[model samples]
Target: MTAPSQVDYHDVLQVWREADTIPEIEHAWLFDHLMPIFGDPSGPAYEGWTLLSALAAQTRRLRLGLLVTSNRFRPPAMLAKIAATVDIVSGGRLDFGIGVGSRPSHPLARHEYEAHGLPFHDTAHAVGSLAEACTVIRRLWTEAEPFDFHGTYVQLTGAFGNPKPVQGPHPPILIGGRSAATLRVAAEHADLWNIPGGDIDDVVRRSALLDRYCTEIGRDPASITRSIHLQVSYDQPSITRDAIGEAIDAGFRHIVLGLPAPYPADVTRWVTDELIITSAYYDSPI
Candidate 1:
């Protein structure tokens, strides 16, 4: 009998500390998701795009992204330009996953947002901002060639997008969260949907809801990709299989697994040996 199918193989690039390691890896990988609190507090804070640009030079096949950037961090126009630049440098391998909310608060419940003079305490604003940002981003990417944007929150006049993204329309946009509003945004604008920290039943239910929403909006449900975020520390084969099975069963073709630390050799090897198989599985029929 043929061997069980495999899942796609990719790596997550995170820089817990500055180090000179191998530049290129065996498979496509994501640029580490940067959190403001993850780095030195007193030192200069490095933006996510800057880190991705540097990683682009180091790795060839490795894809890069913010995993999910909070909408409150940067204005839509500024963020669009930054993502475009990364897409160009990475040869269109950049995948941007954005959400309205932020990483859970640490010692305090609201660290990142409050630092920027916003109502960091509210989750509703975060969700709303994410929706507005997604619209602005897609317009910038697919506007009939650099047009004016006059939205309630963002406004631009006769703006022409220069050095457009390498991807045809734009890099793949992944939207996170499972709220009704976020689901609608994913169905309408997002290329992929990411929902993490939920049960299998929850995942299945949410996926069905997304499909229904897509149909309600006259879009082919299959056109929108499904993805999930996972936390994996050990390199056990069983762990890899379980994660891949869970994601596939939930109707997700994309699995974004978080690394406990940045670029661990063991984790990289595990991804190659196990997750790479899944890519072939996707290509071949069951």
Candidate 2:
């Protein structure tokens, strides 16, 4: 995963293009943020979905997507259309990741909403809207006929999606968040659940809570794949390797290594060699 902030487009393209050729790196990702969340507050931060579409058009054989899109940024129906377009562009390699925007606790994240003239709702509103967004997006992808939707957070009239995503049914929905409310939404809508890697015990507890939510909803908990995003430490590959091992042991089969910028020369190769291949759990079936 590469945060598209504080980096050039060519640099991002270079890393992704390299990763595409490496079979070990199955997927690549970009984060959704209108402004720089780290480094210079005024630094350039490319729009994620736009850049994702560009990357999708350039790469083949590697599944790709925004690490998770912010549901608050765009209307659900419009986002469904955008995602479908990207799926078509990528020949169906898009993994649709989304979340309930940023948390209010993070000052950097909170500022973007106001910066872009987007409302910053309370946590309850954000979570509820996310649930509605998922429902509306799925219907837009799968429903053949135009439909009307009325929900607390979403209202649509004659909403329909044409040129359905190339993927049958729809692209895999990957929801990223650690909140219990978000987990409940994931229990119902996500094909995969992702949380930032740290505090392995807490992650395990969250995973258990998701399982309980799924059980309560009569959905198989195992149906949702567990995913984790572990930040790559350029200076110490061993640290990342240990984290990967722990995440895998914790039942996270999908591991997304977050690459920090400025990306080194042959960074993807370095990732495959030093981080992935040398991981203690590298020999274990993933």
TM per model?
0.77, 0.98
- lDDT of candidate 1 at residue 82, scale 0 to 100: 86
Best by TM-score: 2
Clash statistics: count for each candidate: 7, 0
Find the 10 residues in a row with the least total lDDT in model 1. Answer: 1-10
Q: In candidate 1, how many Å is residue 20 off? A: 15
Each prediction's whole-model lDDT (CA) = 0.63, 0.94
Structural RMSD, model 2:
1.1
> For residues 1-286, what per-residue lDDT tens digits would candidate 2 score against the true structure?
9999999999999899998888888999999999998999989999999999999999998999888999999999999999999999999999999999998999999999998899999999999999999999999999999999999999999999998999998999999999999999999999999999999999999999999999999999999999999999999888998999899989999999999999999999999999878776786322
1-286 per-residue lDDT for model 1 (tens digits): 0000111112323331111232322213332222234434443334556666766766566556765666766788888888888888878888887876554545332554566565553555666667778888877776767677676556777766677899987899988777776787788878878888457788888889999999998999999888777665465656655766777766777766555543455555455445545434444221
